[model samples]
Target: MSKPLSPSSSYDLHPSVAYVQSILANLEARTGRTLEAWVALARAEGPSDGKARVVWLKAQGLGASQAGLVAQRAAAGPGHAFDDTPAGYLAAAPGYVEAQYGGKKAALHPLFERIVELARSLGPEVKICPCETIVPFYRNHVFAEVKPFASRLDLGLALGDPAAVADLSGRLKDTGGFRKKDRITHKLELTGVADLDLALAWLRRAYGRDLKA
Candidate 1:
């Protein structure tokens, strides 16, 4: 059998893992209840549906983010949801990135790495969270995401309203909407390392905006 996860286990040193740990570490202080306490409370009396559970938790005094986290853990139950532990999530993070770059999209891995490196270089607070299809970079909130394709990678930026900025006009393709709070208002396609400079420029602007937000 696999070893049990320990809170003190040596976790992946990625900034994203650290970022999540920071949130877990601060849960009690922020919500006046420990994660286990919140999970127990949620499972015992919270609504069965996830969205409703978040709303219910918020009514019980938890903030939006905290409520969501608690609801997610409760919904995933004990062994799932990355084993409902930081160590489990950290241990699984590398596999998540590997899966994203596997097979025909393998060639885009290097480009993705360059983008992540440049994004990380923007500041110490940048956190890289990898999902199944995209790797999101966060600063207070999600400022950017790198989505890979067989031939190119799309760098999505949360630049508020691209049209309102004259220099950004006609420079980026809209990814649907540019609402002020949209996590991804625009996308820049990158086919090679040559695109890194332009990506970094826009990334820096997005990162700065997130800092102020």
Candidate 2:
């Protein structure tokens, strides 16, 4: 028999823009990673401490705050809110803080700076997330258009070296179904179904129910 989804359950999506949102939502819940916690940690603790925490994260084979961003949501308490009604009241609108401040002061040794910086080198598409980065799990792709795919490999491996991004491109390539890079509109590389499920599975494994799914 086929193995059941471990920690991750299959999502019911309509294969449209809503599908991307669904995948991101599912991914955030499945993984315990969240931007809220990362931001709070960075803001409260000194940069050294933030970097130390990132070291711990790297040891685990993921970037510090980037993992949560890749999953597209914050860690679920303070810095961001889930997309669900009533709950999302906590999450900030995109760039609201930045616009209010009207400037970004660079830090020489910010905690998650490196992790987030390296992530920028990886994804071809990055946009200000309409949702919590921890939940969406990666910066939203600015697609001139969106496309549908059966799996996540094409986007993850688009930059040539899959290792430059996530670790599993080679592995995901062996999937039972063939994936495509179908383009729609300007063809932004927004995610569809598979990656979201993977993120969700990863989340369930990380949080172990200490946090909500």
Candidate 3:
């Protein structure tokens, strides 16, 4: 069987100010991934980068729970909505990986799992790509056989782990689902993102639309 991906993780500093800043700094230092650009939606100050950093610092200071609040606060102008579309636009996201071997995917598998679990628990389904690399590894794996959309985007794996189908009950939508449902597969699945993190982050971002319920 194909080996399983690594573990998952969450932020203790997520819901706090001081801690989150420190954590974000660490995230940036290790992977150079941060919400640095989000800080510019509101009124501009003298130093543009500093303004972005301060807005982020404030958001972190308020804590992870307050992140959405921070998003709202920063989006002060007309019809501002935190511009979440960037998350989907990986081709353009900062630190976004065009291929699998990116460090963020390798280092943060555990964190990705947590995000996936949260999204799956909230709503929508998860599908792990049943790629040539993965299918040979799993024996009892079940997939909802739909046509392939992307040349590289088909296949389903058990959500939490390749072996834990019953426990996690999740699938990654490789085909982007049929017309009624929209599937936004994470390209990192094939990339070198730690398998677990790639799966988790993909689930969170792909299924993010259904999270509200």
Q: Which candidate comes out best when scored by TM-score?
A: 1
Number of the candidate with higher lDDT, 1 or 2: 1
TM-score of each: 0.64, 0.20, 0.18
Candidate 3 is scored at a TM of 0.18
The digit string of per-residue lDDT tens for model 1 on 1-213 reads: 123223223123344445556667899997788999998999899889989999999999988877877888888744332333556666676666778889998888777777777876787788776665677888888889988888999899888776665453455787765754567988898898778788888999989989653
State residue 213's C-alpha deviation in candidate 2, in Å.
36
Model 1 lDDT vs. the true structure? Answer: 0.75
lDDT tens digits, residue span 101-205, model 2: 232321211211222233333333332232322212232232211112332112221222223334343333322211333211111122333333443332222
| lDDT accuracy of residue 65 in candidate 3 | 31
Candidate 3 residues 48-152, lDDT tens each?
343453556455443443344335444544322122332222222212211231344344333333333433342323332212112111112222111122223
TM-score of 2: 0.20
Clashes of each: 0, 31, 27
Candidates ranked, most accurate by lDDT first: 1, 3, 2
Q: Give the per-residue Cα lDDT of candidate 3 at 195.
A: 46
In model 3, the Cα lDDT at residue 90 comes to: 23
- Cα RMSD, each candidate: 7.7, 18.5, 17.4
Candidate 3 lDDT trough over 10 residues, lowest sum: 130-139
